[model samples]
Target: MTRLPASLLPEGLTAAVEEASGARVVAVRPRGGGGASRDGAELDLAWPDGRTASAYMNYDVHRAGAGDDASFLREAAVLRALSGPLALAGVRVAPYYASVPDQRALVCGLVAGCDRFGAITDPVQRDALAADFMAQLAALHRIDIAKQPIEGMGPIESADVFARRRIAGLRAGNSGRAWDPLIHLALDWLEANIPADMPPPAIVHGDAGPGNFLFEGDRVTALLDWELVHYGDPMADLAMLCLRMLFQGFVPLPQAFAAYEAAGGHSVDRARLRFWRLLFQTAFARRSRYDDPDAPPPPNLGMNLVYSTIHRRVLSQALAEAAGVALPPVAMPDAAPGAHDRSFAVALDDIRDTIVPRLSDQQAAVKAKGLARLIKWWRAIERYQPGFHAAERLEISAALRRDFPDHGAAWSAFCQAVSDGGIETEAAIILCNAHAAREAALLADSMGGLAETRLAPLD
Candidate 1:
């Protein structure tokens, strides 16, 4: 535990934590963020008199490729503030301890609770927790952000202006990289559809939803993940809750909204909520995160592919819903077995049977599981990518009324058309949804629970 192995943390962090805590660091264990961008660790410290205490440190030290460190510092500031007068109403955040700004680490007293809200088997138990969490969101939104000006966070503005600034930054960040046409289209559409309403802005848990908060038994313990916290329309948080429910199941939205309204939160604004829902979904699907230094790269790149497929599909569906279009259902492809099927099967067997059992290191076992997901995806690619590619090419050519010699060329042209307004939004969306659906089917087996995601109705 005294060692600063590369797997655990970068060098100097150990020293920084020790200095900040005024204690000897007896141990530190890696604690992965379930779906959030941050990485965390459990640090056990000892004082001079044989007294020891445990603290949790949330950090991201593996971002060696990117240049920014602003987000982590900002989160530390939020955590510090929330522990004081600027805190959310009736909600509990982790107790603030110390922050090592140099290494982007925040140390805090550890609390015990499960972040997995959907895994609870009893529907009544899950409903009770969901309602309590909903009330927590209401309490959070009731905190007038203007009175609690957080340092380094962006200016509080109307929902339209906030969306404008946020979407503009994402568009600028993703401009040249342009890997996903759907993102290009969705961002553009979101830009064009910014809501005109300006309700009282509140300190919203920007990524508020299922899995973002924690509960123990039937009691909500703490709302987790303040990394995406910001001052915006409270309705935006409701929107985000709906989106997160697509992947991480939650109590019904009507039930959730009733809880929110009854708890003294702002009334649910369905229009603004839908707008922010699309905004958040497109934001999550962005290619710009790949370049972000704060974003911890997935242990397996295959998992990234798996996530991107889900995001793209859901994004297209969300966008189409906003545009009042029902996309044609995509046909499922018969995944004909390819030559590498046996190899992929063998690798999965080895990972499950041999490699994983021998991996005494928990981190290594997690990585092995991730690698298995990628191999399964590769197996699907071998079986179906050729047909998917050809189908996309035809769809693009038909949409644009022109032909391209290569799939890459067609993709580039389609995205360009989306950006330039040369093609009908309906046509563009249909094609984008089709492409996303095909990729979803390709990724379904590998994605496990994430494959069958359905957007909850924003009633």
Candidate 2:
């Protein structure tokens, strides 16, 4: 668990706990690796009558804008609506206590007996756990969105609208940047082949996957991370599940789909599921901007870069699948000569030997180690990136058969051409795959283990 500095804790947290539970907060510890959008902490409180209780606090630091509280409220509302139904189905969700809208913070009862499901070692137990999770997901999808309405779920007209809105949102977020041809090609394909028939919008857990839930033994104690909840096609959640399996080794896709259908969810629509999987992967690839000047710096820059690389690779694969083409093999770049700068090596040694041991907070120490690893990666790739990029740009220019001011301009023109139907689908697929492969190779050289594992394409 990560520990937060006293100054980082919200000022009103203690007072809020006192008011809500009539208890005084005795301790507050930050939970490491909080979700993508929020910071979490466990608050230990002592009641006035002498009893003790624990509450979990989640503060929206990234998703909340300057004066808008809508994001926080939206999640709170979803939790409120599904609390009873989920509890009844033996799918536990944290009870909503109170919201500090001003700070964009929410307080809920701290759930116990739940941890990451990946820790299970026994094969039989792991399979049972996977089934249990599928059953819980089915129950969630079976929720009557009309009867138990959640405020601020936004418009839920159809799956196409939802998919388009998401694509539009991603485009809007990155407007004025160099266009990504793969995204455009994928979008064009999606628009041309929108599924005509889809199940009515169900309550979709926008990010349902392995790490998002909590479990103990073979049973899931609680489903966590409801921040992205919204109403959309149920397959959206299923796509996310498959995506999770693609990145993280979890249950097989066929088994998971079987379990879900057997537990009362809609039958798997292969075409729609494929479309959604591509869309989700595209959205992730497009939206990940580690160097965004407008946003705050990420807490862990190395991990951010790691995820960006993974998303880019996945996005390329998804696009190729959509285009019904196979990605060309990625050639490994020649290794760079030994590093002459001893400073990097010295710093890494200091971090591992001197700094990490001194740090009391395990999370901070882990982050420090991550920084060291990033430095090591820099040592490995610093000498090669310039040459690699030049070669890549030359290759891209050759593929496009045109000269442009720079790589960005060339890419934008290529994507625009593809979107305009000037480029053949197969040609676009090959070019995009080459681009994504080169980028992934650079990242893999910098950070190990990213390019080594190849998951079989989802059937």
Candidate 3:
């Protein structure tokens, strides 16, 4: 076992973890898939009674903690609320050990497994794991939220009230930002399409999807990532699972739904599921003002861009499906070589060819790849975006019945029209889809498998 100085963590944090674990920390291995807001690690421990154990730690670097009844506090609180009930229901969840709000950290018993369902290689084994995961999800959804009250999530309400609250919450988050017209249209559609009725709300794992659950062999070890937990439609989880399947492969939706229903979960409500899918995607895909040339990128710049591209494209597609419109094929621009093209190519080669291989640390290598993606995007914008902008501007100008001196001006006007409902629904949907498709093409090479992923048919 290894122990280090107290300074490695915030004051009193190390002691808090050790006291909760009743063991000494030996090894701290960085857990992957952290974003700018959060990070964590797996800690190998040695107990005095000749027992060995491991625990996972989550560090909220953004410290979305502290405020009374803060929404972010639910991340750790929900685990505490559900762990017992879920275990009693034959579902496995990580055991909560401690919450250190002062340090924005949480410790829980580590469940050994990997989150990448795509890596299971064997078809039979992968299917088994996904089925098992569905069982766990079903069991979770079956838990009676009414009977097992979770505090700090606000009082339970009817589905319509819940829907309105969700809309309000999203508006609050979008406040004080440069509005993206697609977001405005998406929000309107979401507000209009709230189901007349919904099943009884349960504790929905709001971000449930591939890469958020762990599995080993034929068993799902535990579901991970509870940052977005809330009491709402459990179908939200299924919908998000579909989204994750597009990014990280899971079993086909038909098979997955079968497993869930078989496990005593409610039958799949396709319309409701799609509504939540649209909600989840649109809520996350809103544009931020980070494209300014002088603005500095956070360390994980690639994650930001790739996630944005995926969400934007998915949101566009979801709108089309919901609106009963078809997206006409979008045009691709021919590459226009620039003075910086060779320099861009040289840097990309150095990253994929030279830098990533020499990095032994898995987490570091992941960061290096992300850096490479940032460069690829820059390269793309230089070589192809001019043509893309030109074509897109022409399309928008015709739709708006006005001509702008520049693409930037045309786009700004188009966005204003869409946001103001000056454009018809079909035209807006097609325009948004066309724009998303072009953006997707630019990021396709960097996104790889995820670029071609489509929503599973809801049959």
Candidate 3 lDDT over residue span 308-416, tens digit each: 7888888998888788998888888797686698998898899888888897655577788888887877778888899999999999988999998899999889887
Relative to the true structure, candidate 3 has a C-alpha RMSD (angstroms) of: 3.3
Model 2 lDDT tens row, 23-54 = 67677776544443455667776776887777
TM-scores for every predicted model:
0.90, 0.87, 0.89
Number of backbone collisions per candidate: 0, 0, 0
Question: Tens digits of per-residue lDDT for model 1 on 1-459?
Answer: 444433466678878888887877777777554353455677787877787788887666664211246656666777777777665356778877788877667787777899888789999898788878888888777776677677766576766677888888778766665556787778877888888876867777777887777689877887776666777889988887887787788877898999889878898889888888888778677653545556567434555666667777899888998788888877665667989899899999999999999986555676677788878878988999888888889889988999999888998899889878889989988988998898788778889988988888766
Better of 2 and 3 by lDDT: 3
Candidate closer to the true structure by lDDT (higher is better), 1 or 3? 1
Candidate 2's displacement at residue 363, Å, is 3.8
Question: Weakest 10 consecutive residues, lDDT, candidate 2?
Answer: 62-71
Clashing pairs in 1: none
